[model samples]
Target: MLKTRTGILLLAPAIVLMVALLVLPVGYLIRFSFYLGQTGVQTSGGFTFANYVRLFGDGFYLAILWKTLWVSFVVTVVSAITGYPLAHFMWKAAKRWRAPFTILVLSPLLVSIVISSYGWIVILGNNGVVNQLLQFLGLTTAPVKLMYTNFAIVVGLVHIVTPFMVLSILAALEKIDPLLNEAAATLGANRFRTLWHIILPLALPGIGAGTTIVFCLAISAYVTPAVMGGSGPNFITTLIYHQFVTLFNWPFGATVAAVLLAVALTVVFLYVRVLSRLGAAAPAAR
Candidate 1:
């Protein structure tokens, strides 16, 4: 009873913060999502399902949702692919050398997100560094149109999220017993085989966690997509902003946010389920 009481006390501040900051705002948004109102400004009316009906029933909103999901998925996959090798290298490095590499991996986070987004624009813009290099290399007569596209958005998001994936996987890797690798090697398991059969299985938790964070951050991100993708109603986040800030349609904006939250939750749930199954099967496969 004492231990339980202590734990509750320890958690009190976080619980209160969550209730005050997260739960209350989300609850209000959900309640507002059902209101019937005009699109031009703030509105109040009796509860109605019109917002949801319009969201699902309209093709434009559906397309935006699909695009958001697609971009987020791409960013998550790219981040995982790029992060794993960096993480594995960091894990294998000498302890003395680890700090520099860790700092390098985390360097992106030191910069502001908006600044990072603009930096991408500098590199990817038509008259930017990339185009200048390409032209100097005689690759093309004219500059490539790289900015304000899905490609630019993916690039920016990947840069921002890869650090999280690397750190997560690295944490899991650090928890692993080093002797396990030696045991596998002594048993004549090659590096590739060891990684596939041992390291990957044990590191599954971190990979799942990293991917989840990347996906959620990518989908809900507004600034990167807004700057890199040109803010043309191409993303749900931007759409939500437009409805609430520009059009003053609070009800519609709230509905959009609610839908996004639902979709993110559903994807995370399914991903966790799949990961759990893989974890269960890992021991048998070994």
Candidate 2:
């Protein structure tokens, strides 16, 4: 009984912090969403569903939601495709190769998004490095129009999220028993067959986790989309920013944030369901 009390006492600070940082803000946002903002004063929780009703009526908001979903989905798919190969290489890398390879995977995370966005601006801009290289290689006479495009946004987001995906996948892949593959080989399984049957199945949890992380990260992104996506690839976050900062629509932004949270939670729920199904199937496969 004393030990339980002691543990609770020790955890009290963390619990307080969580409530202060997360709970309070979320509660306030939800509470505020049920009101109207007039002259910086929020009032009138009318006990009505007007805010949510308004959310569905707007076509632009719906477009932004669709775009956000599409962008996150594409980013997650691309990250998984690239991350799996890199993780496979990492698993098979020699001891000397491991350190350098790990550094390469992690190096992008060290650079700030601001710096990388600027770098992308230069690279994708007209008369920038990409155009210069293309021209020098006799590919084109004029600079390509690349900046302020959805493609640019995707490129920037992929670069940012790849390191996280690699780390997660690598951790998952590493835990897979090497002996499992060796045993498969002993049973006349080829390299590809062993990887398909043994390695990929074991790595599904990491894949699920990495996909969820990258999708959520990409969907909620503001900086890269602001810079690279510009007017072309507006997302839920950008719409929220515009509402709160530009339109002074705090209540609207709160509603949008609630929607964003719902979307993220939905994706997480689906991923969890799929992961659970995979977990159930794992034992039968073995």
Candidate 3:
């Protein structure tokens, strides 16, 4: 009982901070979203569902939401596809080499997201390295229009999220028992067979975790998409920013934020549930 009390005391400040910083703000945002008369910079105190109606009834906003989801999905898929091999290599690497490889994987996180997004611009922008190379190679007579496109957004997001995917998968890979591989070999299983039947099944949890983290980060990403997707149709986060800052429609902006939160929560819940079921079934299948 005394230990329990001490634990609660230690956690009290964090809990209070969470409530004060996160919970209260979200609660206020949700409450403010229901206000009417969301014109220009003025919002009336009267509550209404007009903001939600406007969001759902308009195809433009719906398209933005769909685009956000699509881009996020693509980023997550690309990150997983690319990150898995790197993580596997890291996991299998010699002990002396692992630290260097781990630092390389984590290097992206050390840089500001804004800086990283701009770095992508230098690479993908018209007259940038890609276009310059293409022109030099005579592949194109002119610089290709690469910036301010969905492709650029995906590339930026993949760069931002790949490290997360790698770390998640690496954590999962480390949890796997080395003896499992040896046991599979003892049963006459080849490398491919062992990997397919042993390693992958054990790694599903990591893959799922990485996928979730990447998806969440991609969907909610503001910096990369804003920088890379410039003047393109607004992503949900960008739309929310526009509503709040550009449009000065606080009620409507809050509404968009609420919707984004809902979408993210729904996706995460479903993803975790499906992965949990898959995780439970993996051992039985083996």
Candidate 4:
């Protein structure tokens, strides 16, 4: 117990930082959600579930809420599908090749989101590169509208969140012992069988980690959806932004934000539980 106390004391700074930066702000936000913020002033603690009630009661809000979840699901699934091959490719490469490949995967995260959004606008817009190329190839008579659609939003969000997926899977892949694969081959397991049975099981932990990150990001993402969806196919985040900024309803916006946060946290919690179970059994997996 004394050693535990000492360890806690040693890590007190980090604990304090978490409380000060995260717990405090979250507490404030939760409290703010219950109050009316119409006049730039909190009216009351007034602990009413009016915000929650309204969120559930409104049809438009419900539609966008469902849309947000669907979009996030698509983005996460797409990222996992794409990132698996990339992570596997990197892991199979020689040690010298790993660094360069990792750097490449992480490079996109270096650019600002606003700038990336603009770049996508150029490539995905009606007169953009994709449409231009299609036209040039006689695939289309004119530039087909692509920007400010759900597809464009999905593209941008996937681009932003893919690095996280790759990196997460990379961590798990690096830890896998190559000798296991070799031994499987020694026993006559073909390449596909070895991979599907052995390598895949070992890599499941990383896949879970990647999925958690991807799902969380996709669910709560604000900027990309706002820029790409515009007024076309609205999402929960964009709707929340409009409510807060245009209608001056912070309490309701906070409510929506809190609900979204709850949904994200719930998903992550379930994800971690399943991942932890699978990861714990990894040693016994052969």
The digit string of per-residue lDDT tens for model 1 on 1-286 reads 4798899999999999999999998998898899966764456678899999999999999999999999999999999989999999999998998989988899888889999988998999999999999999999989899999999989999999978999999999989999999999999999999999989978878988899989998889999888999857789999999888887888899999999898889878988898889879878977
TM-score attained by model 2 = 0.92
lDDT of 1: 0.90
Clashes of 2: 0
Model 4, 119-197: lDDT tens per residue? 9999998889999999999999978888987798889999999899998988998898979988999999999999899
TM-score of each model, in listed order: 0.90, 0.92, 0.92, 0.90
The local lDDT score (0 to 100) that residue 136 gets in candidate 4 is 95
Candidate 4's C-alpha runs over 4 A off are 1-14, 279-286
TM-score of 4: 0.90
lDDT, candidate 3, 215-274, per-residue tens:
888889999778889884479999998888877888898999999898889878998799
RMSD of 3: 2.1
Residue 174 error, candidate 3, Å:
1.3
RMSD of 2: 2.1
